[model samples]
Structures are given as structure tokens and as C-alpha cells.
Target: MNDKFFIQAGALLGAVAVALGAFGAHALKAMLETSGRADTFETAVKYQFYHAIGLVLIGILLQNCAVNAERYYHWSGYAFLVGVVIFSGSLYTICFTGIRAFGAIAPIGGTLMIIGWVLLLLAAGKK
Candidate 1:
């Protein structure tokens, strides 16, 4: 894939993270009356934003690096995207909808995050 695509995706995810964070603070404040749940949701948003920034870095690295590590970078980007959607998305849904089913998906997202991190490590280790 093109570096531009990853950059754009990263930027978009970053913007979304901010929007979701704000929404959780203002709009969902009442809905997430329990402080613990609100905190958990906020944590999810924080990690999502961090990983989004990581994606941007990977995009930049892909553009500048002499060696083409497209596969690793692509996997990292996809994992991060999926992780954010599942991890943060599930938390937001559970917080707002009070649906217990969303909880089951949270682990899947967390696993994605672990995989993303491992991919990043392997990418860095590559010669």
C-alpha cells in the first residue's frame, strides 16, 4: 500500500480519537455515570490515540527507509486500526448501551493490540 494512505488513515484515526475523547467527557458523561466505566472508556481512547500516532510514525518511516518493509508496516497499521475499532469501540458501546455482549469483544481487540506491538517490534528488528 501507499505511504500516503497510511498517513491519511493515521491522521483520521487521531482526529477520531480526539472526537471520541471529547464525546466521552461531555456527551457521555451522564450516560457513564459510574466513574470506573468512564475512566475505562477514557483509557481506551488514550491508547487508541497513542497507537494512531504510532501509525503515523510507521508511515513516515516507510517513506524514508531505504528498505521496503511494506508488509510489516501494513500489518501494524491494520492491527492498530482493528484494535481501536474493537477495543475502544466496545468500551464506548458498553458504556452507552449497557450491553454486556460488547465485553466479549474487548479481549479480541486487546489481542490485536498485542499483535500490533509485536509487529512493530519485528519491523524494527528487520535488517
Candidate 2:
């Protein structure tokens, strides 16, 4: 992806994460209280926000790298994206539906996030 695209996507995702967090904290407070899902929702928002920043960093790193740097950076970006979808998406579903299946998927998302960070570190280490 282009720098502009990555930057814009990051910004948008960051904004959405923030909004989701606020909504969970304030508007959903009562709902969460009733369902006992506040912590789960917060967890989702946390990872979403963290990966949103990762997305921004990936964009910045990509902008400064050589052509050969694209592979690792691109993989890192994809991993971060997958992390957000799987982690946050599963949390949201579990919170709303109380399904253990969603909870089961959370670890996969966390693994993706770890892999993304590792890939980013490897990319940076390359000289």
C-alpha cells in the first residue's frame, strides 16, 4: 500500500478505536454492568487502539525504507490488521453474545499481534 493510504487508514482506524472505547466506557457502561462484559469490551478497545498506533508506525516506517523493505513491512501491516479483526472482533462478539467460541479466537489474534511485532523488529533490524 502507498504511504498516503496507510496513513489515512491508520488515522481512520485510530479514530474509530477511540470512539469505540468512549462508547464502551460511557454509553455502554450500564449495558456492560448488566451483562458483565465491560472488561471484555475494554480489552477489545485496548488492542484495537494499540494496533491502530502500530498501523501508523508501519506507515511511517514504510515511507523511509528501501524498495526491498516492502516485504516485511507489508507483512507487519497485514498481521496488525488481522490482529485487530480477530482480537477485537472476537471480544466484541463474546461481550455481546456470551459465546465461548469468540473467546477461543482471542488467543489467535494475540498471536498475530505478537508475530506482527516480531516482523516489525526484524524489518528494522535489517540493514
TM-score of each: 0.89, 0.93
Q: What digit string (tens of lDDT, one per residue) describes model 1 on residues 77-117? A: 78988888899889878877778799999999989988988
Off-target runs (Cα >4 Å) in candidate 2 are none
Worst 10 residues of 2 by lDDT: 1-10
Instruction: Score each candidate by Cα lDDT.
Output: 0.82, 0.86
Q: Which candidate tops lDDT?
A: 2
lDDT of 2 by residue, 37-76 (tens): 9988988988888888898998998988877777888898
The clash numbers for all candidates, in the given order, read 0, 0
Per-model root-mean-square deviation over C-alphas: 1.7, 1.2
Clash pairs, model 2 backbone: none
Badly placed stretches (over 4 Å) of model 1 are 34-36, 66-68
lDDT at 38, model 2:
91
- Residue 59, candidate 1: C-alpha displacement in angstroms: 0.8
